[model samples]
Each structure stands twice: as C-alpha cells, then as structure tokens.
Target: MIELAAIATEQRNPRSRHIDQVSTEEMVRIINREDHLAASAVEAIIPDIAKAIDLISGHLHDGGRLFYVGSGTSGRLGVLDAAECPPTYSTGPDLVQGLIAGGESAMFRAREGAEDDESLGKKDLLDKGLTEKDVVVGLSASGRTPYVIGALTFARQRGAATIAIDCSPHSPVGACSDIDLCAMTGPEVITGSTRMKAGTAQKMILNMLSTGTMIRLGKVYGNLMVDVKATNHKLEERARRIVMTASGCSRDEAIRALGQSKGQAKPAIVMLLLHISYEEAQKRLQAADGFISRTLTTASTEKGIR
Candidate 1:
C-alpha cells in the first residue's frame, strides 16, 4: 500500500501544527498566505498547459470533443468548466462534456466511495460513446484516484488524446496520459484536505486549459468573446457591446447589425466592418471555419469587394 505520509498533499504542514491554537484573524492570515502557493505552483506548469491547449484545439477543430472526468471536488470542477463552454463560447452541447465517478448526481453531493471503482470510469466514457478523435482529461489532486486512472487508460487504449492534471508528479493518472500537468501544490493548510490548495490549483489550471482552447479555436476575437451565446438579456446587451467595440460602430449600428445577423456578434461585427449583408458575412464566417479574423482577411483581399 502507498504510504499517505509520503504524498506531499497528505503530509502535515510544519507551520500549521498549532493552527488550532491560533486566533481567527491569525488563522485567516495564515490561510491567505498559503493560498498564493497554489497560483505559484500553477505558474511553473504553463508550458504543459500550453501544449494541452494546442492538442485540444487541434482535435476540436477536426470535429472532436473534449471530455473531463474525475471524482468529488475534481469531478465538480470538471463539470463546472464544461458547463460554462456553451454560453461563454457559443459552443454546442456536444463539443465538451464532463463525467463524474458517481454520475450527474455526484455534483450536488459527495460521492467519495464511487471514486474507488475503476470500472465505473471506463463505463462512463463508453456510455458517452467516446471516439478516437476526442480528448479526455483526467483530474485527480492525489493523482492516485482509481476512477481518473481508469478513464485515462480507456482513453489511451481507444486512441483518444489523454491529458492528466494532478497535484503530484509521476502520478498513476499522469503515466497513462499523452501530456501530464502536475501543479505540485504541496500540502494543504489543513493537512490532507485537498479541497484547499490542490483544488484551487486544479480550478485555475482548468480555466487556462479551456479558455486557451476556446481562444485558439477562434471563439475569441481581439480578446473579445465574439462567439458568446446571447442567451439572456444581459448577454444580448454584452453581445451588442462586443459588436460595437469590434466594428467601431455606434450602438444604433450595432443593434441593426445584430438584428440582421440574428443576434450573432461575430457576423454582426463582420457585417458592420465590411459593409456587407448579414447573410454574406455569415457565409464568409462559415467558409472560414468560424474564424472572424480569417474571414475578414479574405474579405479585405478580395479586390473591390462589397
């Protein structure tokens, strides 16, 4: 059996040995000080994060999907990121998915015991009909969770691109992945409570991985969320603002273009910028594989166009 004491995450913090005796103010200060370590640890693995982003973008561009699988807090984090992709980037529901060890119900409540069953991980991926072109990311702070290990192994055997994010180096999940992202956010302020520093690092890393992938996929234009789905009044207003900012048009012009483009910010901006019909701008965007920049480049190159 693996010794828990040898694991950095499970090891006791020498400085926090007397945390129980500290005043509330001192406790909060100590916790805040330790929190910076998580971000620092994540900074060290940026190269790996960049590589994973590139890989994920390539597969997604080729009509593949991205999947996140984990258990407990890790699982919840995965689900949270996956759920945000649709509204944030205008991606389809099938584009990115999250699977937890104990299934969807696990997100609301803790299912710690479900993580021990390795076969459930494989079954979940199979249930989703995982394809060879898909990318599967396994998240496990301890790096030894059987559920995540099984998911990565199944992904590898099926020719899917596999990525492992963990807090421990040379983790079991990392060994099965095409790329390993180990943030090495050591022991928690409360000893073995990985929900602290380790979870923070994992969440930060997930933000980078998914946001970078979407940016690379052309969901962003000039740092603006051009592909944002205006599902609500707030988002619709934001979309109009994005069009105005991108096209340097008045609010009235942006509103007209958005109406013509059926609330799509990218095409609306393209229509305003190129003085073209909304339909033509949309066709160009589609032909350019949804890349507004590329479509604009082509439109500019066309002699006496529009």
Candidate 2:
C-alpha cells in the first residue's frame, strides 16, 4: 500500500494536545496567539519577498506573464488574487493565471490525492506553454509538497524563472527554487497543520507580491485603484465615486464622465483632469498606456511647451 494512502496526510503538532482539552475560550486565545507568529514569520522573509518582487516586476515590464501554481488553500489564494486583477485594475485575465492541482474541479471540491502527484504538476505547467519569459510561483506551506516541488524543478529545466513560498526555512521547496521565500512560522499549534498560521503568512505574502507589482505597472495612482473596471452595480458606483472624489466634482458630473468613458475609472479621471472631451481623454490615455500619472504628466508638459 502507498504509505500516504492510509494516512490523514496532515501533520499534528505534539503541543496541540496540551491545549486541545483546554477551555473553549483558551482555544481561541491559543489560536490567536499562534496567528501572531505568522506576521513575524512573514516579516523575516520580507527581504526575500522583495527580491522576488524586483525580479517579477522587471519580467512583467518586459511583457511576461505571472503564473501562480499551488494546491489546496494556497491554490485558492492564488486564484482569488488572479481573479480580482481584471475588475480591480482592468488587467486582462490572461495577464495573471492561477493553476490549481486538480484544475477547476478542485476549486469547489477536494480531489483525492491530487497534491501527491508530482508528474501532474509538471504537465500542468508545460500545458500552459510556460517559456523562459514567464515567472512561476509555487506555493507550499510545508515546502515539501511533491506537486509544488515538481513544478519548480520543471520550470528550472525549461529556463523559466521560478519562485517558491513555504513556511519552513529548511524546506525542500525553498532549496529547489531560484527565489525561495521561507516565512518560518515555526511548528503549528496543532503541530504540522500549516493551514493555520502558515496559510495566513502565505496569503499576506502573495498579496504583497502581487499588489506591489500592480503598483509598479501603473495600475494604481496615489494609493487609488485608478483603473478599476465598473462591471457590476457596486463597482459602477465606486467608479463614479472615484472620479467624484479625485476631481472634486458633483456626483452628477462624475456619473456623466464615467458613463462617457464606459465606466472605466482611469479614463474618466483623465477626462476630468484635462478638462477635455471624452474622445480626447481616451486618446491621451492610450498614448500614455493607461497610466493616470503619465497621462496627467504629459498633458501638463505639453501645455507648458505650448
């Protein structure tokens, strides 16, 4: 029988027993205490995370895709971040892709033993036609998931840039990748249960990495999501408010500009900033590559030159 076939596949920390029989109130307090360790673990890895960011930002600036590969909770986190990119920053879905171990089917229901197959990991990446220009980020809390390790190894063979995220500083996942982020959250309250503190740290790091990249890509302006897509009612209202808040215009004026720009927050902002017609605003934005700062800078520069 496969050794893992009969096991629960979860690591239990020996220390958990000391608290398992404790009062309910204490259980929560213990969990919360464990949670604090996650931040510090991430704090220790900031320099390494920054290194990945610097490399990723450079790759993306050259027209490369940022691919996230993971399993279970990590996979879900990647997919969540990738899905939000389009609506939050008006980026194409193709720009940020998430690959889960069991594919889309695993998103809703857990697939049996999906994370144990290392070959599947390599195939999933190869199927996407990952090239040298693409960057693949493999996430595994234990830093020993066969699926994640296999992906990193495959990426290296293909000359693609690879990054790994794991909780243990001595994790195999860290050793295999070019940029390994070992957050070092320590032993879980429940022993090997990484879904607790380790998961939180991974989520925070992923957010930092992706958010920082978006900023450098010019998706944000002065801390605002200037390029948000107003696809739903809530977002449409937000788009109106973004323009109104930025331009200090009446709600009606903001709504009008948003409608004229097809509910694109950045283009609407440009229209207000230049006091120009929607057509001219859009043309200018296109020239500036949808960057609000650049759009505004070019307009001010041109006016001065004239």
Best candidate according to lDDT: 1
Total backbone collisions for each predicted model: 0, 2
Tens digit of per-residue lDDT, candidate 2, span 1-306? 324222222445455668968999998888898799889989987888889988887788788888888898888778888888888888888888888899998989987389899998899989988888888999888677788888888988988889998876656677878898888776778755667888899899999988888888878878888888888898888888888887888899898888788877777888887888888988887788667899889989999999
User: What global local distance difference test value does model 1 have?
Assistant: 0.92
The TM-score obtained by model 1 is: 0.97
> lDDT per model, in order?
0.92, 0.82
TM-score, every prediction: 0.97, 0.91
Q: What is the C-alpha RMSD of each candidate to the true structure, in Å?
A: 1.4, 3.2
lDDT, model 2: 0.82
Superposing every Cα of model 2 onto the true structure, what RMSD results? 3.2
